[model samples]
Target: MNPRILLWLAVGLVVWAVIPFVVPRYIADLLVFTGIYTVAGLGIGLLLGHCGIVNLAQATFYGLGAYASAYCTVMMGLPSVVGFLVGAVISMALAYVIGRPILRLTGYFLALGTLALSAIASALFFEWDWLTGGTLGIGGIPKLDLFGFLLDRPSRYYFFVWIVAFACMAVARNLVDSRTGLMLRAMRDSSTAAAALSIDLQALRTKVFVVCALFGSLAGSLFAHHASFVSTQSFTVDRSISFLLIPVIGGATSIPGIVVGALFVTFLPELLSKLGDIHQILFGLALVAVVVLMPEGLVGAFGKLRARLAKRGGGNG
Candidate 1:
């Protein structure tokens, strides 16, 4: 909404558009992966940050997108575009059904309940050999073709992912600026106080959950097509936690923070993998530092700092 943000966003989009012409393919691939996962992370952040819902079923929904897309492509022989919509619908429905009951619970109890959903999904992926190809995994998935155009390249996927990420960010930014966002903040602070005024608690939370889920399913569809191969491993416990950490590390207050967080969570491993076994330790330690020192998240802390600086400048003026 601000001109400063619009300017930066335009510049970033331009850079993404031109990246393939200048950047190496491998680096572009890395960025592409980061962008796709960032879309998923952004969805998680939106739900958790605004709606005050901690979701463990993100990977489950994501896997559904991937699997749905796969089924569409392989079984129905349809293009990924159609598959993407179908998969997204499935995710939205599942989230809605689960959210109706689960959203009422708060704190760790809600968390455990959602975590169960994820566990069940992962189990199905592993056990349903007939549909998902079981532990052996599904391979030889054809490249994603849109309108008969092959989007099998990394840079292509990057552009695609960037578009989706930008769209999700736009939605989130709008929500933050709108009255609905204020309502979510109210509920986050105290549901009793919110309900005292007669807020439609169930509908409000359901809307947010479905919106967040749309992003998750879209991210999953992109992931499926990008990898062209997926399995139970793609929706593992580690991945769920990793996706959750992105917003936490980045600060959940704004989309920019989540983007930065996604960058780190998506890639810090290869950056530290020269030490091989020590990479996980370093990653864990870094996360711990983020938790203990920057608990409000990086973006959130920056917002506070900016407000303080503005106050100081105002006094000086």
Candidate 2:
């Protein structure tokens, strides 16, 4: 392992170890949601960041996972863990089926296609009365039970979500550092050149799309189990947009940026709740400001600052 990666792992371990003791239950719950979004955001990073594919229909897969998990646990009487796995498989299969045609479109056309997919998925969530329970949603989904232990408390769930989130980050990091990651970067930079080099553009695109959907599905499954509920309102175009914003806001190129962006979005509303009606206005302005002032996003900006400081220190020495 790289020394820097090892150092980061050590730091992350410390932070995780300290969070439960230092933070209150409410804050811990917020962190739990943050973890869920982090996993989802990492998926967004893979598609939009690494592959330069704008997947505007991410919420479709997310909804599939949540609905699948709900149906499995409630109707089929399966365990939450099994439901989670089933949700992932369903999301992957659906992404493969839908992504093949939709991904064939590029740029704006691709975006539009995904937007249409999201709209259609949202409609189905509302219209599928028998299976999805329509707008009424499915409730009483079981809590996650691993072996004999049950994650029924906020603190327990906080740890569980973070564990899964970190595992996802590790996988994403591995992908980003491998030859496949190199191919993704090349495809993103210039698909034409990549294709000319015989890079199997279609296969690569489809794989990343499925991977992104898997991450979203995993997050959704966790969300359903966490809240013990599933609703159409939870997965909307607006929500998909939020997931997209996460990588952009946090610096799509950096894995840690995804988590930072996720936490920022998760906590932003609560932090601004004191402003009441003006909170929405403030949130929009804040996002706009971030995009305008820091085109490379928060993590990229921070990295630049760190490099500048290091240069100054080297000069002084």
Question: Model 1, 1-317: lDDT tens per residue?
Answer: 99999999899878768987688887787787788777788777876787677877788878888888887887678866887899889889988998899887887998888888888888988998788887776766678666777788997777778878888888888988898888888888788999997777788988888877787788888888888888889987667788888888897767888888888887787688878899999999988988898788988777788999999999999
Give the Cα lDDT of each candidate: 0.82, 0.90
Could you tell me which residue pairs clash in candidate 1? none
Q: Tens-digit lDDT track for model 2 on 75-112?
A: 99987777778889989998999989888999899989
Tell me each candidate's TM-score: 0.91, 0.95
* Leading candidate by lDDT: 2
Candidate 1 Cα lDDT to native:
0.82
| RMSD score of candidate 1 (Å) | 2.4
